[model samples]
Each structure stands twice: as C-alpha cells, then as structure tokens.
Target chain A: MVSKLKTSLAALGLSTALATSMVSGAFAAAHETPLTGDLVIFSDMSNPAPRAVMEGMVARFKEMNPDLNIELTIIDREAYKTQIRNFLTANSPDVANWYAGNRMAPYVDAGLFEDISDVWEGDMSENLASTKGALTIDGKQYGVPYTYYQWGVYYRKDIYDQYGLSEPEDWETLKSNCQTLLDNGVKCFTIGTKFLWTAAGWFDYLNMRTNGFDYHMKLTAGEIPWTDEGVKKTFANWRELIDMGAYIDNHTAYSWQEALPFMLNGEAAAYLMGNFAVAPMREGGLTDDQLDYYQFPTITPDTPKGEDAPTDTFHIPSSAKNKENAKAFLKFVTSAENQTLINAGDALGQLPVNAQSSVDDDKFLKEGFDVLSNKAPGGIAQFFDRDAPAEMAKVAMEGFQEFMVRPDNIDRILDRLENARERIYK
Target chain B: MTQATLPDTHADRGKRSFWRRNQIAISPWLFLAPGVIFFLIYVIFPVFQSFQISTLRWDGLGDPEYIGLENYRELWDDPAFYVSLKNNVLWLLLYLLAIPAGLFIALFLNQTVTGIRLYKSLFFFPFVISQVVVGLVFTWFYDPTFGLLNVMLGWFGLGPINVLGDPTYVTYGIIAAGLWPQTAYCMILYLTGLNGVNPEQIEAGRLDNARGWRMLWHIIIPQLKPATFIAFVVTIIGALRSFDLISVMTNGGPFGESRVLSFYMFEVALSEYGFRMGYGAAIAVVLFLIMLIFIAYFLWSMYRETRGR
Candidate 1:
C-alpha cells in the first residue's frame, strides 16, 4: 500500500515536470543546458516501421534543439547484437538501443553503460518507473525502456471453433485440445526451432509455469542446478506434449517466419510467439476473428502466471563523446509525448514505457497491455534469451531444441546445460 | 667540361654499382618484399595471434584475461567440438568423390558432336553459379515440404524426408550439394588438362594394342598429373572450409549436427548468439593445425617431384 502511494506520487510529480518543461521550451534539450556537437545514436531499429520511428525521433529532437547534431546510425537488428560489444568499447556512440534485462549484464558489469540514475530522478523516474527495475543492475539504473511486447500462444480461433475446442485453462485441457487437433490431422503448434531461441520460449513458459517465476529466475541466473527436480518436472511436462506429436514435423528446419505458413495454412493450429508474430500473421492474411491469443495456460495451477514481455531499451555508453546531449536525448525519448508518438499503431506497435502515455487501440496491443499490467501477478520476464547471459542462453536454447527433437535426450541436455551454467556464471 | 664530368660520373658509378653487382639476387628479393610483407601481416600474424588468444579467455570486449590452455581444455570436453571434427573428416572423405566424378564427366564431354559446346557449358553451369546461390537453391531443393526431392520421392512413394533437418542425413545432404559445384570445377580443370594431352602418346598406346581403361591410365593420366594435383588440392581446401552451404541451408543445426570447425568457430566467436572469442580461436587453432598437416604433405610431395625432375 505504501509503495503504491509512492508510485502515484511519483507519477503526479512527473506529469508536472513534463508539462512545465514542454511549455517553457526547457526540454528543447535539457533544462539550462545548451547542447552542441554531435549526439551520435546507434539503433537496432532496422525493421521498416521501427526505422521510421527512429528517424522521426531524430528529426523531432533536431527540430527542438537546432544546435545539436544527432547522427543516427541504424543497424540491422540481429547484426547489432554482436556489434554492440565492439562499438561500446571502441567507437562508443552517444546512445544505443539494447534490451532491458540481464541482457544488459555484460555491459553493466563491464561498466560500458553510464550510470543514468540522475536521468531517472523526480519526473523521469515516475513516468518511466515501470521498467526502471528491468534496467537496474546491482541497485543502479543503467538505461531506459523504449518498448516491450508480450509472448503468448497466438492460435487460430477459427480452427478452434471448427474443432469444437476452446482455449485451454490448464495443462490437461491443453493436451486434450492438442490431441483432438492431432486426431483431426492438425498439429497443435507450429514452431521453428532452427534458430533455437524459438524453443527457449517454450522452456521459459514451461519452467515458469511448472515451478513459478522466482524459481525460473534462479535457474536462469545459475543459482539453481539445471538437473534439479523442478527442471526435470518442466521437461517432463514438455515431453508429454512432444510425445503427443503436438508440434509440426521438421520444425528444426524452419525459422519462425517459415513456420508461420503452417499456422496460416491451418496445418498447425497455433504458434507460441511474441506480439511481433501478429504483424506477419495479419500480413499473411489472418483476420481478427481468425486470430486470437491466450496467456500460456497454468501448469502448477496457482503458480501466479508470470509473463514474458521482452523490453527493448536505450542506453548511454559510458565512453560517449556527448554525455550531456545523450542524457537529454534519453529524457526526451522517455517523455510521455515521445513514447506515445514512437509506440503508436503505425510505428512500433508496442507498449510505451511511460505510465502517462496511452497504449494503442489495436486488439493485440490492448490484450497484451492488459495481460502484462493486470493479469500477470507473478512478474514480467525479459524472455529466456534476454534474462540469461548470452553464452548460457545459446547453449541452453540449443539443448531445448535438441530436447524438442529427441525428448529422450533430456538427461544429456540437462547435464550439458548444468555444465555450461557452472562455467558461464562463474 | 663534358669529358671531365663523364670521368667523374664514371668514378661515382663504381660505388653505385653495388646494386648492379647484386642485382641478380637483389631484384627478386625487392620484387618479393610486398607480397612477403602482406603475407606476414595478413596471414602469418593472425595465425600466430589465434594461437596466442587460444590461451586466454576473451569475450572480444574488455581486457582478454590470460587463462593458459583453458579454452583448449573446454574444447577438448565439448561435444560440439567432437561433432565438428567428425563432420569435417566425413566432408574430406566424401568430397574427394568429386575428383573421379569430374574425370568421368570430362571424358564424356571431351567429344565433338554437333552443339557439344552448348552441352559442355551446360555441364559447367553449377561451377559458374555463386556458392551462396547454389546453397539457396539446394536448400529449397531439399526443403521438407513442397521440395522437388520430396515431390519426386512422393512418386516413388518412398519419403517426404527432411534431408537438411534430420541429423542422420544433414551432413550427407550438404556434401551432396557441395559435390555438384565441386564436380563441375574439377570437370573444367580436367577438360582444360585433356586439351593439353599428348596425342602422340595416345597413338603410341593404340599401336601397342592398349585401349579404354588401360590406355587412359597409362597414357592419358600420367600426363594429367598437374591438373589432378591442382584438383585434389582445391577439393581438400573446399571441403575443410565448408561453411557457406551449412550456413545458408541448416546453419549447422538441427542441433548443430552439420557444424564443421569453421562454422562452429563462427558460431562461438562471431555469430549473433556467440561472443566467446577465446573458444573460437581455439577451434580455429585446431582447424589451422589440420590444414597445416595437409599443406606440409603437399609441399613435401611437390618438392620431391620437383627434385626428381
């Protein structure tokens, strides 16, 4: 109750700061701070809409502070992941886009990111308070959240209706529904484990559901042994589904995009994916009535439904040339107005960071927002890959893919992951 | 003035003539310096650096900590490392098939019926296509659903086999794709070699009542040794560096079953999911050692032949 009151008070304080700053033109950059020189930004907003949004942000920021030269270099999203380490140490950008969880651990531990706790003070802290926890490491905030989206079972609603089935609320019901779909010549799920991270989604939900959120966190953070009883239980649950032949065959051959045709063509009835899948699914010709979502069903029944909502964020590199300009840009990005603009339906189509910013009216956005905000009681995870260290995540996800293909190999896979965890976390 | 100056210049030339004195030996050294320098910097230095890095634990960022033999220790225990080594050996053995297959194709195409030029070019088409494109084409060809291979198998009612997906067949499937272009490359080399064949020897063989296999083996093959040597050398190198097809087709997966040392190195070091520079360098060191053995053998054999001549 006390924490809730503090949050509201922070939000109120933020509202006033945003208003006064906007009206007085102080946010043209930062208050009483004139910006000069180059404000270089390295963004992984390579996808068309996100790229446009990045460009728009730069243009708007430039318009406001004409003295500032903002050089925005947008890189291919996947390529940016590996390149960030190089540039952060060598050719540091003023600002960069990264994820908001333990994905930031390597950078934070290496002291690559600047301590941006001052940016989070007063008005900014309240507005962007929700994701402050995600960007924090060892009691210090390192970055600010720009966007996030939910991961869930995106299913074919029409196929469910055709098979006289409804969204399963439990494991048994889910299996039964899958059995029905299988008996009627449809695979229960269409997954492409070729890149391996797709399989991690299943692990994230299965482990979280079987054990609960805190246990899942411990496992990812390498505190819990991968060969633990809880981990085995999670794999056992996954095995039942695999044994039922519930997934599309040759899934290891397809990427998530390639796997979409199975769901789109109705050979498979559902896909366990992020909100990003909705765009491609819609583009592939599924109607709103045809496509629907459900939170991953409860496995332990009362494990307090934790959710995966991977958040993409912005950070200032500690070695940046333009620190003052970078800080101002970070504040400007998280301002209620900019969050609303960039995360609009026509732009990122994702959840805004600012509590004061309104969410888009799109059905997926609304439901994802509701599930992330109200329905999820356990906690929000930054997905498996983002939550775990990069090396462990890669090894574990490959193990997940192997288990999916050969469920009997669970013992070997777990042992391998346990070995990796010991080496990686140490 | 001209006569006096000429005598003085002649005296100066006596000292400057040190270059002229050593010109025969010095010219080649001077000419070779740039190539030698580039080879040392680009090739030799990096090779040594990889060895140095293999003794450390680096994430390609921050200070790389010296942990002598640690990365190699990890590699020794790594299952993925063993899988890659075994796959590389398998690739080396099967990829050699391209040589005999290329010879057969070259012999078949070494004819002059009408429009044989068009047929020869057609036979040479696979080598002309980029490996990336060939990789893509084969990926689609071997795709599980709606693939031409599966469709044809459907006629035989045999299979809808996912060649690239199944761990059992994945390496073989990729090797087969590699063989297509490699066979073409060898065929082109053999054809060029066949053009330089001594017709006098063929006549001598015919006069000795030698024909077909005997005549070709004794007469033709003996003269094609250089081409055969080149073909064998290239094929081994190609087999060892089998990355592009694996990358484009399966990405060394279906549980990373198709990974060779090079692809595995890229995966652990440079790929989006990977950043273990130390481990990658260790793998690279192993690959380098493997290549070095083959290279040493090639050099020894070449020197022996040259010395014999």
Candidate 2:
C-alpha cells in the first residue's frame, strides 16, 4: 500500500510539471519566427528617447539590407558597465555602446573593439572630424560618437530674478548668490552623491576654474598627484562651500531624481546637472521659461574653459560577423539627417556634432550651443572620477562623501585616495 | 582425443569469463556517465579554468601572459581586499543570527489562526522576490528623510539618520536588508520541520512534565536538526556569495566601506578600475578557499553522521 501511494504521488508531481512546461512552451511558440542568423547590439541607453533612436536605426538598417538579421539588447543603464564587461568577455554582442575616455582603455587594450578608423575615413570621414579628438584611442578611431551634451549649473531663473540675482560671472559672485539663496531659507545647492559620480561635476567646475586645461587633463590622466596644490585648492574650496551649509543634507540617500523634488518645491536654488536633466526639469512641472544654465563660475581669470561634455559612442566587436553591414549602418546613423532627428527629440538634447546640423529653432539646443560656443579654448572634461581609474573613482567618491559628512577627516580622506591611486596605478 | 576435448572446453570457459567481466565493468559506468559528465562540465571545469586564468595576466582579451603568483602577492598588500574580506566575515557571522530568529518567528506563527495560511505566505514573501527588488525596497525604507524607517523613528524625536551614508552603519544596514529574505528562507524550512515533528513524542514529553524551553531543548530542538542544518548551509553560502545586495544598495560605498570580496574582485578585474584579472582571480581564489574550509567541515560532520547511521 505504501509503495502504491509513493508511485501515485510521484505520478502527480510529474504530471503537474509536464503540464506547466507544456503551457509555457505553447506561449513561447506563438512568438517564434524563423531567422537565418542573429546579430545582437548591446547598449545602455534604453531610456525612451535613445531607445526610439536605436529602434529606428535598426529598422532602417534592416530595410536597407533585408538579407541581414540583428537582435537589439538594451541593458539597464546603471548596470551596463559591469554587465557588458561580462558579456564582452564570455559572449560578446556584434556591436555595443560604450563611453569614451579612460573608460574605454581596458576594452581597447584587450582588443575587444574592432578598429573602425578605415570605415570612418572612407565613409563617415566628415562626421568623425566633428567629434574632434573625443573617440580616439591612441591614433585610431575605434567608434562613432552618437550623441553628447554639455554639463553646467541649471537654475531657476525666476528665483534668481526675484532675489535680484543675475547669473554669476565669477567665483565671488557665485558664492554671494549661494549665500543670498541660503539667507532666503532656500538650500543654496542640491545634489545627490549616492552613486558618487555627481561629485565629479563639482570637482570638474572647480578644477577647470582653478588649474586651467593642461593641468586638468594631466590630473584626470592620473599623471599628476591628487594631493598636488592645484587639486588641494579645489578640495579646499569645496570644504568652504560645505562649511557654509551650502549643499543639501542627506545627499547620500538621494538620487538625482530625488533631488529634483526639493528643487521643484523651491526648497533648493540650483542644481549642477547634465543637459539631459532639462527634460526632467520640465517633467517635474517647471516651465521652460523658468529654467536657465550658467557656466560654473570661473575661479582663475586666466584659465581657458572648454566644454566638459562626455560623449557616447558605438563600436563593432571583434567577433562581429557583419562588419561591412555594421559600418554602413554606423555611417548611415551619423548622417546629418539622422543626427538631427535624434537630437530634435526632447529626451535627447545632444549638441549636434555635425557642422551643418542646426537647432536654431529649439530653445534648449540654442541654450546648449550658446554656452558651449563661448567656453574657454581649453575646457576640460569632468575630473576626479573620469580622470582617475574606476577603482580610484570608487574610492575617491567614497572619500568625498566621508569628507562631506565629517569635515575633520580630511587627512584620512586624502590618505585613503592616495593609497588607492598608488595601488591601482602600480 | 580426450586431451583435445579438454582444451576446447577450457577455451570456451575463458571466452565466457571475458564477456561476463566486460559487461560487469561497463554497466556501472553507463549508470554514472550522465551525472559525472554534468558535474565535470558545469562545476569542475570552470573552477580549474578560473584557477588557470588567475595565474595569468590577461585583460579578458589579447594574449594572456603568465605572471605566476603575482596576483596573490598583490592581494596581500591590497587594502580594499582586506576591507572586503573583513566585511565578508562580518556578513557571515551576523548572517547566522537569522536561523534562530527565524525559528522564533516560525514558532509563534505555527499556531492556527483565522488567516494563518495567508499570514505564512505573507511572511515568506521576501524569499520569493529577487534580491534586487529587496535592495530597492530596503533602500527606500532606509532613506533618511523620506524612508519608512525614519518616519517610524521620528515618533521618538530622533533625527533622521542616513542609514546608508555613515560608513559605520552601511554594512550593517545592508546586512539587515539581506536578513529580511534570509530569515524568510529559514522560516519556511523550520515550518516544514515543525509539521513533521512527532506528536506522540511531544505527548510523552508532557507526561514527563516537560514544557516550553525545557521541552524544546530535550525534544523539539533535537528534532529540528535537519531543518537547522539546511538553514545553516544556505545562510553561510548566501552570506559569503553576497554581491547583488551590496552592489545594488551601496556599490560597496560610502567610501568602499561596504566592499565585499566578490564586488571588489569584479571592480579590480574589469570595471572602471584596472584590468587586473589575475589580481581579481586571486581574490576569488581566497574566497573559494574560505568557502572550501567551511564545506570540508560540513562534509566531515555529514560523513560522521552517515557512518553512525
């Protein structure tokens, strides 16, 4: 009787399992389509704007070359860095999105990316020149710049005007405006350093203002000592701001979006964020007329300031089978008409790299160009995290947080960063 | 004529013996082949490959240059490695508290009530969700100004503390997040064990005047050993292999204060950090070896138990 019961129970479990699998199998079969081959495109920009651009690109490319097939894989933006690294090593996609900077160094050094300099020269030559030197590793162009935007202090013009404040042209004026804002019971600044990357903008503004272009480049390249006078001065200024109660409290718990509410409620005066933040500003119920941008105040009168925008790019993986088709697709996307379409979407407020590309009619694009065009000749990209290695970026940002919350730990903070830098660079 | 007949019979016997031996030898292998092949390919092969990769300096591409034990040497001096290792130990030690705590909750909820079954499933919900979702929920729960925890604390007139900000409390905070799901897992295991408890044994203990803690120590606790063992096994593995919670919650932050070995390894080998794959592998090897020691202890104890049985 016991044996018979055991057999019956086992039969019951097997049938249930089989029933579930068959149900799911039928669901899967409904979506199945025959394909000769698969190409996967990995990217971090699955936010609506970039996603639409990518989908359109894929559709156009597929239509142009009906014989070729591709699969577009959108990785979460936050997790993309780590996930794509694993994918590239184990099962690389045909083409993938990546940032340009020392960020791309490891992949380039490993030869994970296929060199597409020839493609750029032959087909996309004019588009390549517009990016200047942004996408080059050594002398070769490894990827095509898709879109990029300027970074600056985005503030409420209405609040500034009500307080009789004009956009500050120099450091002293900026500090005074901050004080004025604080005096009015509004937080002078709002920022979220939860990920530690936001602090890079602050460091960039200060370093660019104090040390100028060459030193800024060298500092980011890890060629200069972070403890050097120029770097220290930037930290000292940051400390001054912290001491004045200038920044928002509990920044560690807040993400950039969380900080938005404080600004929207008029509890905060300004947010030093990227151009993409403008869309959210509008989304958060701020009118277009209420928003404005200003260069982070110039610290040194003689320093030349250039645009500190980070650009995104795409490259063919060394393992790609459709190299020729991929290059053609890349070339097609970078064409003036496609780029115009990409930027015209409010979600992607990228400054067109194409000289012929114009957004004279769009106020946001006009605002972006006005700021970027007047930037000092040797404007530097954001420093600290971007300049330092990723490991160092992690350590340095953590140190910045510690320093912010506990100002007395300056010695310990600097020492920790120095040690991390040595260990990583060595 | 008789000698020739004897030779033929001897040859026939030898041929028959050979056939029987060959069949006997191949039958056991045929039975073992599937599982052995799977274990080799999925588990053993990757481990050896990782070990081999750990010995060479490669950036996940290009030619791998042999750098023999330099990675291990670097790990000795790497401070982040130590921080992460220390945190992993903290996670393991503190994570064990889940088992007893889980049992306490399980025992309380073991009673029949109007909605007892629904309550049990609700209690077990944390275990069902992915850790990423759990991390996000706890991150909000621990948010300084707006988090539910702070709102609860506000009734006592305490300032909103940045649970994730302070390096001192960050790891503990993340561990608390981990404990949520881990406790749920243990609770389920204990509930099953409690259901299988012998009622006659309980009645006999009562006749002997045993009850409550005394009864638990002598009878109930001993009976729950199988569930307890499985819980311990899972908790230890989960604690040591913890990456997702740390990654999602802190990214090993407030200054690498929450760095765990697994995350630090990935950061070192591939992320924006240096491509020290060998160094990363050495860190992994250390983690693997630590796990091995625990596994050996578990195996030895199991071996003794099985032999005694």
Candidate 3:
C-alpha cells in the first residue's frame, strides 16, 4: 500500500500534475486525440478485497494503454450511494459504479447515465447478456456488470450431519429439517431484519417459490396488488416458519452482519443470505467441509425456481468530459480475461458476469454460478430492493419486518402496503 | 502635506463624518451581520424551503413538480407519520423527567465530601461522552443474547427483554438511553444554580422554622428559577429534536416504532431506499412547526417574566 501511493505521487511530481486531470482542458482543444488523455473513474470498491481488485484492474488497464493516465477515486461504499447523486449532476467522473435493475432507475430517468446501447451491440451483447436485462431501462442498456453473487440458504453441513438431515428438496422436508434443528435447541435460520431488507429477501424467495417469477416481478413492478391471494399465500408460508420460531430470537436488534455469530457458533443451523456472507462465515473459522449451499426448496408443486443475484455495474455519466477513454476503460472491464481475473476467488469471490469468462474453481463460487445460470429457470431477481422502486421497497420491507414480529398483523400490514402501492405507483 | 490634496466641501465633510456619526448603531449590526446572515441562510431559509419543497412531488434527482400540498395530504393519511409524531410526544413527556431527576442528583451531590470532584465528574461522565458512543454502549447493554442487561436480569430470573427490538419497549428503551446524558446536563445546570444559593436566606428560613420541603420550596427553589428556566427551555428543545439516539440504537426499527420526526424525515429523504424529497420535506415542515410552538411559548413566557420584573 505504501509503495503504490509512492509511485502515484512520483508520477504526479514528474509530470507537474499536468499529464492527467489538468490536461483534460488541453484534450478539448484537439477534439480528436490519442488514448493519451485523462480518464477519471469514481468507484465504491471500498472494502479491502474489492479495493485491491479495483486498484489491480486500474494498474492492469494502465499497463495495456501506457499513453492513458486514469485518475481513480474510491469512496466509502455507504457514502458513495448518496455522493453519486451529487457528483453525477455536478462534477461527474468519466465512469462511476452503481447497481443494476430498478435501483438505477432514478439516475437513468434523470438522464444522468449515458446510453451505451452501442457498447452492448454485436459480440458484446452475447458476452455480457446475462446482466443486460438488469442494466436496461426502457430497452436501453445504461451499464455493464462486473460481478454478481447468488442468494440461498448458506448452511452448516456439520450441523446438518449432527441432526442426521440432508438438504431439503421440498418445503415439507425443509420444515422437518427446521423442526429437527429446533428440537435440538438450535435456531433453524439466522436473519437480521433491523435494516429491513433481510426480511425482504425471505419475501422475495418465498413469493417467487409460491407464485412464480413473473408474478413476483409484477408485484414489485406494482401491477399485482399487495392484498392479492398469491401474496397472501406467500405470507402464509412465511408465517408458518415464524410460528415455528425458526429464526433467531431478537433478530430485529441485529444487522445481517451481526447475526453471523449465531451460525458461526452453531447456535443457528443456516442463514438465508447472499453469497457475500460466505467470506465472513469462512473467516469465522468454518472450513470448506463445514460450509455448504442449497437452493431454497420448492413450495407449490412444479413451481420453477427463482434466485436473488444482485449485479454491480459500471456506467458512463451523460455529462462526463472524457467519454472515449471511459468507453475503452469499460470495455477493458467487461473483457472475458479481465472479468475472469477480477472475479477470481482470491479477489472478489463472486460470480463473473461474462458468460465466456471462466468460473473460478472454488466450491461455493462454482455452486453459486451453477445455481444462478441453470437452476434459476424462473428468472433472476435483482433483489426486492433492486427489483422494486426505492420508495415502495422501503415501505414494503418495513411492512415485512413488522409482519415478522407480529404475524397476526398481516391483514393490517397488507392494507397498509396496498395503500402505499397505490400512491407509490401513481 | 498628506491632507493637502483632500477635497474640502460640506458634502465631503459629511461623507467623512457619516461612519463616525453612525458607528454606535451600525457597528452592532456589523458584528451581527455575519451571525444573522448565517442564521437566515442556514436555518431560517431552509425551514421556508422545506415548506416550499413539501408542496412538491419530486425525488431529489429530478425536477420537483409543484403538487400543491399533496405531500402533506399524503402525510395526513400516513401511518408512519402518526407513529413518528406519537414517538415525538412520548419523547417530550418522558424526556422532561430529566429535570427532577437531575435536581435530586445535584442536591445529593452538593456536598463537601471526600473526593467530591471525582464523584461529580463521574456523575457528569455520560454528558461528556458523544451521543453515538452512548447509543452504541446502550445497544450492547440491551442486547437480548448476551448483553449485561439480560445477564443481570437472569440473576433475578426476570427477563431477556429485547429492549430495542420490541415495539412496546423500543421507544422507552431509547428514551432511557437519552435520559442518561440529558439528566447529567440538567444536573450540571442545577449544580451551577446551587452554587449561587443564598446562605443568609437558608439561615433566615431555618429561624422561621422552614426546614426540609418547606425551606426548599420557599427559599432554595425560587432562587434556582433562573437555572430552572434555562434547563426547561433547553430540555424541551432537546426533546423535540431527538434523533441521534433513535437513529444509532434502532434506525427506527422493530418496524418503525422508534422513529422521531427528524429520523423519519431523514429516512424518507436520504436513506438508501428513500428518495421522496417532497415527502421528506413535508416531515421536516411538520417537525419545524412542532418546534416552533414550544419556541413561541418559551419566548412568550420570557417576555412576560421580563415585563413583570
């Protein structure tokens, strides 16, 4: 880290700071120039591993095109969410990191994101085709996905063995597994709903399983009413688990990260969480033999499986000064070789978006990639928050949290959500 | 020679003398300008702007469409709004307990005992710590799984109460956390008030057979009126603007049961899932009005007190 900073600082001093950002004005006078111009990229790869990946990608990109001097600024992830709004309209970087699906709707609608349909055309379409639907708003692709991960019941294989249980293939077996775990004084599931979105994950999988992907999509899209019979049945299924005390006690007090200790300590058997959780669980001393993954089991017969796989993407702001270099940078990012390198197990530990890219030979990564690509025939949801508009997601997720605490308040909660849906959709 | 080139006329003389003539009146304004301008720009204008924005139907990213109080109209039917308002009321009523609590602590500690300064600082410790730190400490203290609170309760075989997680107990739990700092603040105020208490009056009251409750009510209490007034004003304002403890402890959770108006305003406008600037502005406006009522009453009482004097 110290050496990297020294080199960057040395580069600045050698060029009198004119070789990079300051020379952008010079590029404007020429109109058409070499790839030698400045390319500013604002990214939210703030965590240590992702930070290394971002810095590594930049170093590699710089090496390929020695003429280009790219300026990278990494913001803290939480701050980046709000700062993206300000910087997009005012001081835009050439490229920025944002999420996929309806999460980017506001920026897309406000004309902040540059339409990159041309980038996605031809061979590019087939390469990054998996996340194209996620980045597209109103039939126009706005961004390209770098990596994504699957969401499922990440469980302790060791705990299952102790209980003499196998991976559940159906809702009946899933419940019986939960019941056995509960009988042995273990929480069947560990979830933290304090932030409210974790509860939304349960709703997403349950609703998708009970009804179907299309129904779930329409419901989030505000076409299906909250009080619909299908929605009620999903909640009914959820209520059964709640009634059984399957989730950890006082879950509302813990963040998703804080709830990991339950599974780590064997107080809980499993967590219905995103694949990102594997890193922490592994860090908490669970060996590969101890940890395992399974697709959330079926509820209604013949219901096609659906999975939550949120994609993180990069985009060019519409008002960005250096569009040419930005496009080249993005192309480099989505290239098969680069995707494989950046999304490798030692780096992001996530599934690569590029279909042509090689999946890393890690057990969880391979299973996640397989589950997302093949097992989820119904469709891939971007998550409840990303699938629905932000306002509706917040209100609905809060309702989901309330329902978890008070199962009997389901009718009142449905009515409240129904009311919100009318107004939010309007 | 330096003055030789100066214009010598009635108008020139008047111009030169104008600053000198108006210095007393204008100098105060010059001092006040920076503060007043900042106050107007930062505080007063934003309050008015919130009112204007509340009348719109816009997210922060797009052009705010003037929806003519539709935001407020929505808030009228909104259950979350009522929950926030109800919590605000609960905060106001419960937060006032600090005054009496602080007074008692202050009175008890108003002694010349050994290591008295140490004891006073110990009592004043909660106020000195940052609210965020206090909130974090209380969160762990109230943790249902392995918190000190539940462990202590286990000794009595009482409870494993998830104070921050249960709707019935969440708001009160946060309020209790808030009271830790607030009572210290009130204690400090009363401590200072106790310093200026008249020894002669206490002696005179003792001679008149006024002791214990009677002496406190007649002599000591009236003397602490100034401190009491300041404490009342600050505590009320603090209670109305309660956000940090609620935010740090719960983020308005156990299903939005712990949200005060400010936290709700922030949640609706700024939180990741929240983007309805218009709705947030409406919440801000409502919170502002609630604050304005107490401010007006306090200002009116001060005016009446001064007039009577």
Write model 2 residue lDDT over A1-426, tens digit each, in one string.
Answer: 332343334334445333443222211222243224555788888787777667766665565456568789888887787787788778887788987776776678878888888766642555446464666778888888777677888898899998999999988898899899999988888998777778777777777778887887876666777778888887888888899898888887677888888888888889988888888889889997788888777888878875577778788888777676566656656655445545654426577655445442456667766666565477536345655666667777777777777888887677767766676676
Candidate 1 local lDDT, B71-134, one digit each (tens): 9889889999999999999999999999999999999999989999999999999999989999
Query: How many residue pairs clash (N, CA or C atoms closer than 3 angstroms) in each of the candidate models, in the order given?
Result: 1, 5, 0
Question: For this target, which candidate reaches the highest TM-score against the unseen true structure?
Answer: 1
Rank candidates, TM-score, best first. Answer: 1, 3, 2
Candidate 2 chain A, run of 10 with poorest lDDT: A22-31
Least accurate 10 contiguous residues by lDDT in model 1 chain A: A20-29
**Candidate 1 lDDT score at position A7:** 31
What does the lDDT read for residue B207 in candidate 3?
Answer: 92
TM-score of chain A in every predicted structure: 0.92, 0.86, 0.92
- Docking class for model 1 is medium
- Kindly give the stretch of ten consecutive residues in candidate 3 chain B with the minimal lDDT sum: B1-10
lDDT at position A398, candidate 1 = 87
The candidate, 1 or 2, that scores higher on lDDT is 1
Q: What TM-score do all the candidates reach, one by one?
A: 0.94, 0.85, 0.93
Estimate the lDDT of model 1. Answer: 0.89
DockQ of 1: 0.72
Candidate 3 lDDT over B16-59, as tens digits, reads 56675566699999999999999999999988898898998888
